[model samples]
Target: MDYSFTTIGALIGMAVAIILIIKKVQPAYSLILGALIGGVIGSGNLILTVDTMVSGAQSMISSVLRIMTSGILAGTLIKTGAAEKIAEVIVQKLGEKRALIAVAAATMVICAVGVFVDISVITVAPIALAIGKKAGYNKASLLLAMIGGGKAGNIISPNPNTIAVSEAFQVDLTSLMIKNIIPAVCALIVTVIIATILSKKAGTMVSDQDLEKHADNKKLPTFIQAFAGPLTVIILLALRPIFSIVIDPLIALPLGGLVCAIACGSLVQFREFAEFGLSKVAGVSILLIGTGTIAGIIKASALQYDVISLLEMMKMPAFILAPIAGILMAGATASTTAGSTIASQTFAQTLLNAGIPAISAGAMIHAGSTVIDSLPHGSFFHATGGSVGMNIKERMKLIPFEACIGLTSTIVAVIVYLI
Candidate 1:
């Protein structure tokens, strides 16, 4: 016995769990439970089970803390009314005819920055929520806009997810980002168009009275509060290649969040700030860290051989399999890097063994990954949707239009790859 569960069973279980969670099962609980099951069945020891759980929890430590900091930063911004001011400035510049453009622009910037930083829904959601409130815009629509922005960045940015995926595929991060930039730009245009049409139909019912009531009255804190949130993250990312000489992004994420929080004013007490950070970050952290750890445990425990054997079945016809697998991975993991990297490595490798051009295989998968990267479980989508009070179900309803945007982008990507 090679000491692994049946391949079919493992695949089926993974598929079921992924679908169920994507469909609406709480990810944190589902992931924890799934890891437990994997531990018990794969290893058969309580002590090992305990270690698996601990490791899973441990993986989230850095991400969770960073998210918490983001939440606190967001809270501070809101309580201090800094976000409101920024929105006012944005609205002033864009005027009525181009508010949607501003929204799209903000979303793009956030998503781009997110590529190299934490990009926690916890952090992004609140900021979107405040913008939505101030502008009388439909929250869901705004969030979806942000999703388009964030997901686009995730595939190409130097963020952890992209880095992880790129490393797996042995590709350069800047090259990947550059290669995908054209399609990403096209996708962004589509997203903006969609947001504009939807915003018009979603019918901004936000009354002038309501906007006035929530507007920020503060004179503004140091330049930090004014330029915090997404700005800081962007600056950090721009300097990251050189600054990795100093601290890691994981640490920088919280540090950025903390700077935002302190600059936002007295809205959040130290304790409240702490609590705010914990709750916001906790949900996302558990999902990413827990699932990541479980994947790690599977690798460490040598269960990947079973996965490898199954992948062997799809060795020929690299183009189709690569893209399909990449899309599937993106949809399942709800992360750009995870999906693309997995597809590039696993599917591309299969093709390579058959003497196929790995670039064609990699390109197809990367295309699919871009589209799949916008799933409901994706933090970019969730955070954007959540920002506008559009929870998962309502968000899913918008999938058709989003899918169209993604489809267009994927087609373009495929064409580029083929050419």
Candidate 2:
């Protein structure tokens, strides 16, 4: 297939898949079908199309296997009440007067340890929900706080997106973290403020009496024991540079789970928690695999090259093009990591050639890619909804608005970086 046809076909496939996803189609079907269409149009061979789809799915599963460990850790925390103990301690220390802030702060710290946003949401939702009930805060506000803070950490910390950008630019992890720290902090602050305002304006607050029903009376774990698991994982991640060791999430997370289980005196229940955790994450895992498949197909089609070529031919300013590219790709893939990686790979050199600093360009790309990945169809959105006990329609009422705020913050970050 010629470059022009392949390019147009790939674009069409992406558009179709994104539209289907937005319309509430299952990502598995939409992405697979989209890949098939692109493969057929680009390669003009039926066998190649099937191979591409299979290979794409397999590759995605391999890449994300470590992330699945997070699910096990989440389950252990929830089952043992360790997560709730952490939340209780935070609220107790900060007081109900600053309840919302406490929740946001806790969420930021949890996600900053490089936990997946979906897993973070799942692990924290019960605790946040109970806190909201006791404090009479709006449930939506609590949910937004968790999501926003988690997303900020997910995008900027030593997670998949940061790793992807760091590799793409050949920069060290510390450098990427340094560049992203300010923007991530800014985004988190904006999200918390917006969530609080929206909660008050919507009057979605629950009565304390109503909240009592959701409260658990189980003996809360000691602060040190409750926090031991997450702290261990965080410390391990932090020591990576000093030890020159890669702490794979797969191993680290399971080890954390074991530690947390033992600390809670529930070591025997570890197997049960692991089973439950895998079940909770099963659907999301499938969705991620599908997303990876689509990403693989896009790569195989050499669409990134065509996209870069088109942008170069248009002579668009790096500042102007960077955010747009980040938003579109991130939105389409429903993954900040995939989007940032694509943007960096396609445009990092372009921006540098245009006299933009690599650090600044990377931060811009990372910020832009993250904000829109919280779209209603994204896995993070669904996970939050399920964790908070809200249905899709109910979630749609507020999630999109908050996500728009997130997108705006990132856009501001882009402008600031450029300036």
Candidate 3:
């Protein structure tokens, strides 16, 4: 590939941003500085840089503002004890004798329907701990199962990662879901098996007295009421094809939250939930704004074309190159959505050039990026670890195991797509 000063400069800026993020700089600030560096060095026009950044942020807001609805729904679910209720019902149905499997299954279901993993962890941790202790299962094993199952579901679900990929690559959402189902199920099975093995080895016993103390005392919503929000979102999204209903996730999520709120409590409760949800939106919005600016700068510089050319010259097979690109980008960014967006933008044409189908390529990218996104530095890792009461040292051991399982899942997806 031919070297251009602008392309080299853009690459350096991205590297710098990643380094800063790894060093614990706030992502929004690091990404903003990175965008400025790329824009100034690449185009040498400060006015254009500022315009692009503003326009990009505006565009991202229009596209992604609905993320707030999911946040609101998450908050409401946690505060109302709906999420715990959902876990309770699942565990009850699965029976306490198989608590490990029950926790994995429940988490998989919750995440597959678009609940955020961190929110799910916070909501389910108390119940999971109690269940594990009661069943004489290892706490670490149960936590890993919850994390792994949720990760597996998120990879294939119609969540942010898939939505970003769909927008970036122009892939069909329904087709993506259909293609991903088998791989997702396989991944979940793998997670359960791994957790079961670990539980057996740990072999920690729990006292009935201890289980009694940890028993839930919160006034939980009914099963139907508790699940109303998430179920509504899932059903609407699924029916979009048959009904041609175009249920925007932003609208669907908030509507679901409303349903749950009204079913379980009053408008007053919902107002508080909305406020908490908006607060959740604030942090993510800043990160997206920065990422959007970087995307705009990359586009302005036509850096994606150079990236495609460079990959073409490498002559790597799609099956091998796709996952490697995914894991590296996702690992660095600590975001599956960001990784998918970058890969889809940078390599869509490259995959086509290699005779790879877009659907398969998208799946491979999703799998690879998702696997390593929960690294120690990732917000999800911190949030999940904190929710489960695991200190940094304890989490350090568990996180790698979870990441390895995610990597294995990604490889399974790659192989499935190839076949």
Candidate 4:
């Protein structure tokens, strides 16, 4: 892993890209530029830049597809009014003094569902918003609640990312969860408690008039009715894989998404379905492409390989590396799911192949992913911020403490795993 001009350039480019993203520049474009600059720095030749960028683009295929599928499915849920129905039911249940806790709990539940479904923004936030308005608190509280819940689940839930990482690292889900769930739970509890205290101390109360004005007044479908669609898709997706036992995620993803769409009554004849699907494709595709491209870039640069090498070189104790890597990657990626998934699947797997303990590797990977997942720049935080209307700065104040619970949980899990 000697440093080359290309390596130095890539590092600088990455820094620039991060700064741009922080400045609110378009992520896709920023990432692309970063890749280009990194390539140029590494090779020091104009001709190499084109090839490097293409290499980066090529690498993103899988990630892009995953994100695209998730986005479109999410969009379809929103457009079809399925998400709304679910959110409505959640709001009705969050009815009084313990309103904050209700929102937190509901958000967590919805996020857990989102892990399998993969459209957390649409899946978790609408319910949070409805509940927040009902309880007369700012949308930020509700939004953060949803975010914390979803973030916890994103790392802990049955996401392909989680599964992929676990399997790659030679660990089981049960082992990882046993060690990680407590921290995730604590983070969420803290988030709700903080919101509740703030709401009360600030004397935030929604008047009857305001509540009535905000109320939809439309009768929603029953929870069973609403849950039926997603539930069906989940079962089928589960079965589809076991049934085939050789299916790829790309095909399976759309299959599950389509099924969910149909279950939610999206089958409004071929022509209408075609039209709606077409309308949504652009946004969804962009999101997918962006993430994929970034993933591709990482792959192409052999960062995963390099990271694994670095980890091997560390020669640190299992207890130490797991939390350190998890925290660093989570902070770097702004996604526990992404950070943990990548590190686990890449670095941790490499370590396991090198004969590290499976449970230790598993616990560490989970620890790394969850701790960073709580950061302000993380995707979950951004989605929560958008849902609640808070800027990153405001979110920073509360989110870190919640995330710490996850970090602490991860550390404890590692210690226990080591023992």
Question: Judged by lDDT, which candidate is best?
Answer: 3
Model 3's TM-score against the true structure: 0.87
Distance from true location, Cα of 129 in model 1, Å: 10
The per-residue C-alpha lDDT of model 1 at residue 230 equals 49
TM-score of 4: 0.71
Give the number of the best model, judged by TM-score. 3
TM-scores, one per candidate? 0.64, 0.80, 0.87, 0.71
> What C-alpha lDDT, on a 0 to 100 scale, does residue 92 get in candidate 3?
87
The candidates, ranked best first by TM-score, are 3, 2, 4, 1
Better of 1 and 4 by TM-score: 4
Is 1 or 3 the stronger prediction by lDDT?
3
Ranking, lDDT, top scorer first: 3, 2, 1, 4
Per-residue error at 212 for model 2, in Å? Answer: 4.9
Q: Provide the lowest-lDDT 10-residue window in model 3.
A: 202-211
lDDT string for model 3 (141-219, tens) is 8878888778777776656667666655566665666677777777778778888888878543444554565566768
lDDT of 1 at 19: 65
lDDT of 2 by residue, 1-419 (tens): 22322665667677778888778788767877776787678778778767766765675554356556666776777777776667667767887677777777667666665455666667666667767777777768888888777766665565556655665566655556666666667777877787778667654555554345455677868988878887877666656666767775567777888898898898999999999777766665676566555555665666656666777789866465567767777887676766776566556666676687777777778778876776666677787777767767767776575666557557766767856
Those runs of model 3 whose alpha carbons end farther than 4 Å from true positions after fitting are 1-5, 43-45, 172-175, 202-216, 299-310, 318-322, 348-358
